[model samples]
Target: MKWTRDSYRWIALAAGFTIILVGYAMRNTFSVFYPVIVSDFGWTRGSTALMYSLTLLVYGLFAPVAGGLADRFQPRYVLAMGGVVVGSGIALCSTPTSVWHFYIIYGIIVAVGTSLIGITPVISVVSHWFGSNRGGLVFGVLGAGFGVSLVTAPMYQWLIATYGWRSAYLMIGLCAIAIIAPVSLLFIRRSPHHIELLRQKDTDTGGSGTTPGLSGRTEEWTVRRAFRTRSFKLFLLIGFCNMGFAQQVTIAHQVYFLQDVGYAPMVAASMFGVFGVAFASGNLSSPLSDRYGRVPFVIAGCLSTAGSVLLLRITPNPDSAIIPLLFAFASGWGLGVVPPACFAAMVDRFHGRNYGSIHGTMILFISLGGAVGPWLGGQLHDISGSYFSVFTLVQAFLIVAAVLIVFATRPASMRITS
Candidate 1:
């Protein structure tokens, strides 16, 4: 069976989008359970936070393995297995009777599921199908899954409210299997080669039958080669620092911080919706890097994220309209630029052959930062009794991230050019 060129593009996009949606939906469902799980289980705040941290740690650690698997085997199979694991884990979560149960199900199983179906594999697939100009746009559009959870989270919350948390987990698990499994089996193909007739049609029409502007040069640096490069080291440092700040200030603490600043629980949750919107908006800006260069967008985003941290620190009240506006702008700007720039740069530097393995390794550092951020935030809040210390620390991290980005852009250093 072969697909037409147009059909191939659409199928690839759909596959990419499906992976994003399922992974993000599973990841964000945790927030809806936070309050309820703590109350019912009598877990300490730190203990509950640890579960999420562990999830991040595992997801990050396993990403490289997942990527390697995708590289070695079929992406569709990897994704299908991921759906099964994640759906089962979430369903099992409905029956947890102890903290370790949450740890094993949510922290370990679901984390493995996420790594398999999440951005690491999706990005690798997308990189195979698109070139420089369209790549950033494609990545941005697909990456919008991270934001999709904003809408899904509330829906999950409503489901939990209507039923019980246990029922909610079961339902979400069912949804994951129903949605992702079929999509993976029916639509996902490893590459354009899967569609022979489509290739002929494209070649007949004078199309290259490959991504436009792609050199088709498969010179890929292995994980060892990538690590030996100065650019890779700098990227790891930048990713660690930037993700640490973003995860701590936005993903982990924003809800609690909003509550501390006098907003109701519902309001705090709504603010996450706004954050999602900002996140999507920021992603939209990535393609612009194709025209203006990745350096400017990367620098601007890092600086803006730093500025947002400062705004939160200095604001008299986070509930104030001005604070939300500033936070949204900064966060959106940062989130959008970092992913596409970082991804494109790596591919450009290393080329496509080893993209999965190299990028997967980089994501491990990003995941490590994400794992530490929330745990550190919870610890700091427990010690200081306020978000001020955490915000200050985030600001410092962002500043360091910005400095690393500048260092990354220097001439005479290895940089990726599409």
Candidate 2:
């Protein structure tokens, strides 16, 4: 065999896409069950929301471990095992008779599974595939999972309505096992090295394929080094501010906010669907960063997100219909560009032997912000009986996040090699 372009790249992309879609579809569907779980278990909204916060915490905490495992072992086994755990956890969640059971199954177990199979593994594999044109298109395709969930959520809702929530869980769990196992076994390769071997006739004829001067250089910073860098510190701050705001609005209160203003349950759910549409569309803008630049799009996305939050705050009831759609578009674009842009910047600044480790550490910080946002939003709502304070706070954070992005862009003397 000879190393060829067509041999394994497309196979890897297809498998990667399937894994992402399934993982996110399961993760996002949790919101659809939030109300039902609360009603059935007679738990307070705050209690139910606390589970989400805990889930995020666990997911974040487990990410680096999962990333390290993927770096050391085959992703196929990790993904297959993750699918089994998540599927079983969700199935158990459906049958739980107590709130603690819900927490154990949904919050801990399912979250662990999600963390293992989610962004870290998928992005790591994709990163190994393309270098120059990697950031925009890869993230854009991965972000499309947000849109896919719009379809999955409603379908799940219908299943719950017709067959009951327990049945819906069982169905989805089976689907997860069916999809993830074969895809991982058939398509996932450890690295470009594996792909190169599959395409080459002889080992001696094949080079490592890494860039020449970039190979075997270990000045690459560890997680500690990344923390010490001015750029990394600024990136962490930006992540905290932006994610704190976005998670609150999008995850914690968007549905309730719509219902309070005037929309019915069905209509409110559809509004989330619209938000998904905007999210998917924004992903399309990510690839453009390769052409223009990362920082510019980050600035644009931040401003757009802030403007949308402002619009949501002031819109009257009659105008609320238009607001959800607008907010979705703004948020979609913002989210679409941010991850890839930020990750690419990190790689550019700190391309070391431990890229997975460093990036995973940063994500853990962002996940902490994610945990705080929703829990805080729910607590404030419980106290104030309105989301007014929460939305205002979100706007403030977005502005601050924009400033952090600008600040993080200052030229740095540090560079990492292989």
lDDT of 1: 0.73
Q: Give per-residue lDDT, candidate 2, residue 146.
A: 49
Model 2: per-residue Cα lDDT over 247-293, one tens digit each: 43465567667766777655666677777676667666777777887
lDDT (Cα atoms) of all candidates against the true structure: 0.73, 0.70
Candidate 2 error regions (>4 Å): 1-3, 193-219, 315-320, 413-418
Ten-residue stretch with the least lDDT total in model 1? 193-202
lDDT of 1 by residue, 1-418 (tens): 7786556876777677877877677877776577678778877666787778888889889999988887767788898889888888888889999988899999999999988888887777766666545666776777666665555655765777789999999989878978777787777775653233234435644865454433464444678876766778888887787754465346766766766677665666666667777776767777777777777777777777777777776644644666866685677567656777666666656655457778788879888888887777777777778778777777777777777876776654564433
Query: What would the C-alpha RMSD of candidate 2 be, to one decimal place?
Result: 4.5
Q: Name model 1 segments beyond 4 Å from true.
A: 193-219, 314-322, 415-418
Give the range of the ten consecutive residues with the poorest summed lDDT in model 2.
196-205
Clashes of each: 1, 2
